[model samples]
Target chain A: MIAFGILAIVALIGGIGVIVARQPVHSALFLIVNIVALAIFYIILSAEFLAAAQVIVYAGAIMVLFLFVVTLLTAGKDDEEAGEELSGQRITAGVLAILAGGGLAVVGVLYPSQRIQLGLPQNFGNLRGMGDVLWGPDFVYLAAVALMLLTAAVGIMVLNRPPRKKADPEARLKERES
Target chain B: MMLLQVVLLVIKIVLLIAILMGGFAYTMLLERRLLGFFQLRLGPNRVGPGGFLQPIADGLKMVLKEDLMPDGADRFVYRLAPVIALFTALSVDAVIPFGAAIHIFGLTVYLDIANPSIGLLIAFAFSSLGVYGLVLGGWASQNKYSLLGGIRASAQIISYELAMGLAVMGVIMTTGTANLYKIVLYQQHHGWLWLPQIGAFIIYFITGIAETNRTPFDLPEAESELVAGYHTEYSGMRFASYYIAEYINMITVSGIAVTLFFGGWLGPWLPPIIWFFIKVAIFLFVFIWIRATLPRFRYDRLMNFGWKFLLPAALIYFLGTAVFVSGVL
Candidate 1:
């Protein structure tokens, strides 16, 4: 429980740091912290598989790419430039955030207590359990997600495909003359 | 009882770190000596018998050297990078069982630190995280070479990691487990996996070399091109940390290879722990041998080899393994 509290505090600080950090690279690092903390939270809940996946996919793979792009694009850039190009945007965002928070609070109070479960099955998040869930009755949902990812991958390949070279007109004319 | 368990855990961690660090030192000496032999040279034979004390000398020299931080560097991350590198490198060993459990003083002690159900995945996760150190170190150095090195390291690691993961999936499928100890036990009953999964083992070894940023794929720190790569701006102990991390990462990769494909710690007559070390040493020798034999890959060719050749081969091998394991063909 104490560990959980500490992790919660760390995650909160990381969330704040992502927004407060001036540099893009620093923001990415903070996001890693946040993701890692959540991964540990999954471990605390006995979801070792999820925890590992969380770290591997989120903190390890995705964040490395995030940092890569940020460094490439924003390296050595200063963050002090501020133009009031979108005046009152911050105020509107803050107002919407407050309203959303209030709405969530109201929902929390009004929602039936029965919706929340107090106990979990043993090894409920282990590989065996996860495999059963993913490959058994919920296999259709898993297939759908896999297909979506495949589509995205094919799209990337298409976008990166090089333009086909056109035959040279002068070469053709020279060959015809010969 | 809880106190006793905690004490045991702490003892295990200390011992593990001590052994791994010591292994790192000697692995460096071993590489130097082997490389020298391969290149027809004497190789550091002055200190102690056959240069056995060379690693100690190297450690002292590293500690005594002046630590330098490049001007205009990011102070915080520059300091943080090596720590991240070494930490992740060492943490991967926690789940690798060194041998069968031993009975001592009315208590049973497991040879490994932690044997979580997702031990294999944990190793993958920590290794993936290892890239942060190189990338951050390069980016923080305020050197174009370092930044480029970091970028190359990330791209190379990410590309090869997919092939490595797919290759290991063959072993996991055959054994039906991710726990290292259990995998070894399965091997004891079913024989070593290398013969059955030879194709995957070959692919795994190749990708493992790339993942560790070793020769033929050591483009990240290709000194000829990048001026020592990501740690170009690092000096003294910080540089030593990166060095130590790389060697230890080599050991971790070899250790995993042993556990997965070579029937870890299973040998006739010899003790299990000794068997584990012997297998690991063999893998380490191959690593150095490859380093001495192959020239570093050109950048574009390295990426092409990883993405085009290794990835497809791993996928095909994995599919075959799955079919066999499931008895579908």
Candidate 2:
């Protein structure tokens, strides 16, 4: 219980820091901390596979990508002032966040009797259990996810391809030679 | 009883940390001496007893030297980066079983720190987190070379990590467990998985080299290209943290290789701990040998090899092992 409380505090602070941090790199770091805290929550719940997957997939791969892009673009510099030209954007985001928080609080208050039990089964979140769900009835969903990722990769490749010109093949060859 | 257990746990952790620190120090001395031999030069022989005490001397030097931070650097993150690196490097050892549980004073003491159900994944996860140190250090230095080095390290790590993870999946499929000790036990019963999973072993070793940022994949700290790479501005003990982290990571990878493929602590006519150390030493020697022999890979070529070759090969090997294990092949 103490562990849970500590992780909760960490997660909450990380979430707030993600928005409050000045540098993009710091924000990404905060996001990583939040993800890691959530992973610890999974571990505390005995969802060991989920916890590991969360770290490997989310905090490891995805967050590395996030850090790469952030560093590439910003170089850890806070170039733009907070809420300078995005005053309305900030207000809209604030209002949406408040609405979501309130809605979740209301639902929790209304459904107090509908709270799920915390105890999980013997192999509830192990790899075998996850594989059964992913490869059994939900195989189509898995395939769909793979297909979607493949399509996105292809789309990015296409978008990134250099433009081709019909004229001056000899000139192009000479340019390359030079 | 609970207090006793807690005390045992603390003792185990302290012992492990002490052993690991000593191991890291010696491993550095060994590498330097070996590299000197490879290059036909005497390496740090002026230190006590044929440079046996060189690491101690090096540590003293590092501690006494000035710690410098660039004027424009982010002071906080600059300090935090090496801490993160070293922490992740050391923490991965929590899941690695050095030997089987032994009877001591009527209590069965497990050799490892933690034996989590998802041990292999935990190791990989912590290793993957090591990139943050390089990236943060480079970026926080506020130098162009550092930034480039950091970005390169991050990219290389990400690419190689996919291959490494997939390669390990092949072994996990055969063992039917992610627990390191269980994997070792399975190897003992079914013979070494490396015989059948040779491809995965090769891929794992290659990626392990890339993951640890050693030559020929040491582009992150490629001295000729980027001046000290991501650690360009670092000095003294702060720099030593990153250095120690790298060596510890090399040791961790060697431990993983031993656990996953070579049958951890399963040898004839020797104590389990001795067997484990022997295997790890062999792997460490191989790492240094490769560093001595191979020229560094070009940045683009390294990326290509990781993504184009290693990733696909690892994936196919993983799928093949999975299919075979499931009796679908």
Candidate 3:
């Protein structure tokens, strides 16, 4: 319980830091900390597979992508002077952030009244159980997810394709002049 | 009884760390000597008998050397990077089984630190976390070369990780478990999964090399191009931390390879621990040999190879294994 409490607090602070941090890279680092805290929470809940997946997928692969993009674009130059031009916009964001935090706290307080047990079965978080869920009755859902990911990949490829020579006005004009 | 168990656990942890540190030291010496012979030269033989105490000398030098940090570098993250690297590298060993549990003096002792049910996934997760160290170090250094190196490392790791994970799926499918101990036992009964999962094994080994950023995939640290890459600005013990992390990661990869494909600790006549070390040593030797033999790959070519060839091949092998294991083949 103490571990859970500590993790929860750290995750909460990390979540706040993600939005509050001026530098994009720092924000991404905060997100990583938040993700790691969540993974620990998964472990404490006996969802060992989920915890590992959380680290591998979210904290490892996805966050690497996030940090790469952040570093490539900004390179840690997003200081306070360059951030948020309008005061009204900042005020609105602050109000929304507070609302979201309060809403989450209210949900947490009310969740236990629903009598939903968080305790999982002995095998529920094991690889066997995860495989059964993925490949058994929910096979169609898994297939759908795979199909969606494939479509997204194809979309990226199409978006990234080199422009046709004929489609380039400068090239067409040069060809005509030649 | 509980106190005895705790004591045993403490002992195991200490022994594992000591052995791993010693292993890392000797592995460095072996690599230097082997690389020297491969290139027709004698390597570092003056420290101790046949350079046996070379790592100790190297460690002392690193400690005595001045710690140099680039001006305008992010000091906190710069310092944290090597710690993150070494931590992830060492912690992944928790899931790897060196051998089966043995009974000693009316007590049971497992060979590894912790054998979680999702041991395979945990190992992958921890290994994957090592990328953060490279990326953060590069970014923190405030150098263009370091930043580029970090970016390259992250991209390479992310690309190859998919192939690596898919390759492991084949073994997991065959064994029907993700636990390393269970997988090893299954391999013993089934005469090693490598025969049936040859394609997966090959892909796994290649991806393992790429994951650890060895030669051919060492574009991140391509000395000719990036001037020692992301670690160019680091010095002294901080530099040594990254060096130690890389070697430890090499060992961890070899251990995983042995456990998954080579049948962990399961040879005849010899003890299981000895067999395990022999297997890991062979893999480590192969790692060094590949580094000596192969030239570094171009960044674009490396990315293309990983995504185009390795990923698809691993996917095909994974699906094939799944189908065969399900008795539909």
Candidate 4:
């Protein structure tokens, strides 16, 4: 009821926030907010696990990676290296975002979520159900993804580890405890 | 109908502002006291007993202080930066359930402003929005130190937020809900969510500190390097916005932690609000304690930790929880 109004407001604000942020990095961050808000809308619709997964996958995994890569490349200096000129890339992103957002709005107006979802158990699609599906039917696939995640995690660890340096007192204490 | 909604929204905004500003005022005093405790010394007993009114004095001073902007600053964005930072900080509460639903007259009123179905995501979204303040604040200041610091913040938060999100995902896996109240309810029937998901707790806690620009993980505002970092150029209420935002954010983080892990408003003896506040305070103490004890992380190390350590751990935890859930449920 009232919840829909609030989500609409949040989505609108977050959408504007994406545009309002002066930097691409900032804009990217705002998009995280928009996405998360959308995920929360999913939660309100009783798609509980989907909402969490949305934050987990999109906000946690994708956006952070996006921010990290952006920062790593740009943190070396200000973004002026790409030239102060508002290049074609900016125009393209703007048009694409506008078209997508406008198109979505039209869709919403055309069809305002009429099909009622039945038997949406409170915890459906949560880690529990997700696990049921994963182990029952999707175990092999999940295992492969697990292997991939492991490889990626290991790869990142190997890539990002600091050069061996003098251990801190805390590290020494920890080692001693272990 | 629209008018009523507008009025309600305005009231919520006002209440939010009051809570934040009030919390910010007391948080200064609380932090100093906490810092002093960690250092084993009495702190700030000068103005009032135990510096009870120190924040008031501090606010008065900040308000009266020079509102200076460094030269060559981006006039528009520089000024706009604080507002954005402050707004995003305050906006997260639109969905967070402060306490259980309460009845006033005939209306069943929940303390949270928005409480949108996707409440958790709204909070995360606002958190992501927060990085802009740091970036714009730094870029607008025109100081090289500020620029570098701001750039670091841009990089660091964006990087760490990923790990943070994953950590939260682990929680999502367990509770299977995104609405704060539901998350809390999920926590209530089960054991404290943190016990089973220790890895998620650690990752989430560490990255949360980074997200909120707190100590140890606080490379963006590294005092030794950037001379207040992104906030070098801000003063008065503008500066207050950043500090205030940080404290309010501290409350938000603590509140979220309580909801997600500590069983929000479920403890007996006291009312739900009291339990929520107490839990939040405990975490807030942990924040201050960590600040007092730990050394700041080098910038590169912060990124490495996020990517290498926290993210992977969160993923593993999520998978384990999911499997466990599959077996049990």
For model 3, how does the per-residue alpha-carbon lDDT over B4-36 read when each residue is reduced to its tens digit? 888888888888888888889999999999999
Score residue A65 of candidate 3 by CA lDDT. 96
lDDT of 1 by residue, B20-62 (tens): 9999999999999999999999899899999999999998999
In terms of TM-score, the best-performing candidate is: 1
Clashing pairs in 2: none
For each candidate, the DockQ is: 0.69, 0.71, 0.72, 0.12
TM-score, chain B, predicted structure 4: 0.94
Residue pairs in candidate 4 whose N, alpha carbon or C atoms collide under 3 angstroms: A33-B125, A40-B118, A41-B118, A44-B117, B94-B114
Candidate 2 lDDT over residue span B239-277, tens digit each: 999999999999999999999999999999999999999
True contacts kept of 2: 0.71
Per-residue alpha-carbon lDDT of candidate 4 for residues B194-254, written as tens digits (9 for 90 to 100): 8887888888888889888899978888999888998988999899888888888888888
Give the Cα lDDT of each candidate.
Answer: 0.92, 0.92, 0.91, 0.78
The TM-score measured for candidate 3 stands at: 0.94
Error of 1 at A77 (Å): 4.9
Q: Per-residue lDDT for A1-178 in model 4, tens only?
A: 7988888888888899887765666677578768877987977766656776676567655765575555444443343434646659878998999999999999999989977876666457654566678778989999999999999999998999998865698887887799
- Summarize candidate 2's per-residue lDDT along A1-178 as a digit string, tens digits: 8998899999999999999998888899999999999999988878889889999999999999999988898884554665666458878988999999999999988988765776777677778878888888999999999999999999999999998874989998998899
Predicted candidate 3 versus true structure: per-residue lDDT over A80-165, tens digit per residue: 45645666897898899999999999999888576777767766765677778888999999999999999999999999999765
Order the numbered candidates by TM-score, best leading: 1, 2, 3, 4
Candidate 4 Cα lDDT to native: 0.78
Candidate 1 is graded, for docking, as medium
Model 4 residue B312 lDDT score: 81
Task: List candidate 3 stretches off by more than 4 Å.
Answer: A76-80, A83-87, A97-113, A165-178
Number of clashes in every candidate structure?
A: 0, 0, 0, 5
| Rank by DockQ (best first) | 3, 2, 1, 4
